[model samples]
Target: MEIGSSESQSECNLSIKLGMEFDSDEHAYDYYNEYASAIGFSIRKEYANKNNAQGM
Candidate 1:
């Protein structure tokens, strides 16, 4: 995903809160991945606890 200047800036100011909604898990990953890259970091592995059946 190509982030424009303004969008990239927002990514730079990345924050996490409880109950954040994303289009999909990949979308969430991309969002964080971009933020991490901009801050001179990379994500090698990801582990999240989610209850898909219960939509938690």
Candidate 2:
């Protein structure tokens, strides 16, 4: 999920919280294959967009 905080200098934070069930082999494989890059890109894009907006 994307979070914004005024106290955070970077303006945005990305966090991945994994539960024990998600640590299972089946879930881990799916997470690495399907969700990892999308999550990474979402955080990166959101931060970049916010930065650009702030600059303008």
Top-lDDT structure, candidate number:
1
lDDT of 2 by residue, 1-56 (tens): 25223234243333345553565766655555444444433212222343565674
Model 1, 1-56: lDDT tens digits are: 43343454564677545698999988988877877787556785557798999978
| Residue pairs of candidate 1 with colliding backbone atoms | none
For model 2, the superposed segments whose C-alpha errors exceed 4 Å read: 1-15, 40-56
Against the hidden reference, what TM-scores do the models get? 0.46, 0.26
Q: Which structure among the candidates has the greatest TM-score? A: 1
lDDT of 2: 0.42
- Candidate 1 regions exceeding 4 Å error are 1-18, 46-56
